[model samples]
Target: MQTIRSINLQKNLGDVLRTADVETVLVTNRDQPRAVVMSAEEFIRLKTAAGEPVPNEVRKSSPTLHRRIADPLGYDTRDPGYVEQTASDALDGQHADEIAREIDKAMRRWRLR
Candidate 1:
């Protein structure tokens, strides 16, 4: 996924929409993801896979108007609930493979892996 700042999205709506046609674009506000813009076909496939009924208007609208943002941790980085830690914490008492696993874990946790 590629990230685009909210201001940039506003300034280049057409370009952003075009990019969304190829891949998911994460729209960010203050460096935190706020929404996702994907191709209409992908959205419908996702909804169908999830067993959610696709309304006529939604099918017509496709990817626009329907907004979905997922944050499994329940908050963004700007929130006080988010904790920032150093890599040293993971390195302590851990072997090389363990350290690699920890790195992989963090990336997967952020859905970036």
Candidate 2:
């Protein structure tokens, strides 16, 4: 593996990227490794070989929120009410009045009931 200081990374990023096939380049700051530089294809291949899910470009081409919604015992909805429920849960951590004001503004803009 090749090691380069953070300063060298800024100066010779192109050269390091070009030599990615020979070794994975490690970027260091304060003599401690901070990041790695490798070809995207190599990184994806390594991740897939390690049994991690590789993001599908076909799925990206045709995106849907249905893929993300959690199905607890197969009980989930495509309804706007379900979205509002999730939004409300997310906003629970914040000030209720502020969240309500923001929701009201969004509803007005979208002409939502």
Candidate 3:
């Protein structure tokens, strides 16, 4: 809840930012808030704790690719196109079993299994 005029931000940005415990510095223009300056680490920690999705660049650079996808557009989860099946689905029906057997035979022939 720190506020400073735009001119002050330009003059003593570092000092103003250092005064806050949460590192959120509000910049104001003409007595109205215009922008915020905060530490990137703090911002990321807060966003993660709030269950917000990290940016794609952050995800791509991360060591793990297991982050949950956050869709704000309200996608239709019931759509068949959105559903993904596990390998166990290969054993679910006669047609799937036949396909799995063919795949297994091909893998054995190629020494892949």
Candidate 4:
């Protein structure tokens, strides 16, 4: 975490934003915690890691989201509307990648196979 005074952030918006894009920055007012400045990507990633719901505004802001939303063969697993097929045993190619994602999610949360 990086600390940036609210006053400095107002003066150095670009530098602060660029830093926040790669990591979280803690914002403070008069040396007391006040707010946080973070990139939407970091915010979404953190939310996913914590099993928290990401806001629609963050989803809509992504330039590539609309294209992903339109992709039928592609999987936007982050989308709340994403559904796993009922026929898991089929192991057909259509949803193979999605199945892999399921495994990945389980491994990340459980740290075990």
Better of 1 and 3 by lDDT: 1
- TM for candidate 2 is 0.46
What is the TM-score (0 to 1) of candidate 4?
Answer: 0.52
Backbone clashes in each candidate structure, one number apiece?
0, 0, 0, 0
TM-score of each: 0.51, 0.46, 0.41, 0.52
Considering every candidate listed, which one attains the maximal lDDT? 4
Q: Model 1: what TM-score?
A: 0.51
Question: What value does the lDDT take at residue 95 in candidate 1?
Answer: 48
Q: Name the candidate that leads on TM-score.
A: 4
Off by over 4 Å in 2: 56-113
**lDDT of every predicted structure (CA atoms):** 0.66, 0.66, 0.59, 0.71
Collision pairs in model 4 = none
Q: Write the per-residue lDDT of candidate 2 for residues 4-113, one digit (tens) a residue.
A: 99988878988898878567899999999999887655766676689987566512322233548444322234222346665676667635565677689779989994
Per-residue alpha-carbon lDDT of candidate 3 for residues 1-113, written as tens digits (9 for 90 to 100): 77888987767866876765366888889988898877555665667789998675533322212236332222333222223332334345535555666689779989999
> If both were scored by lDDT, which would come out higher, candidate 1 or candidate 4?
4
Question: Worst lDDT window (10 residues) for model 2?
Answer: 72-81
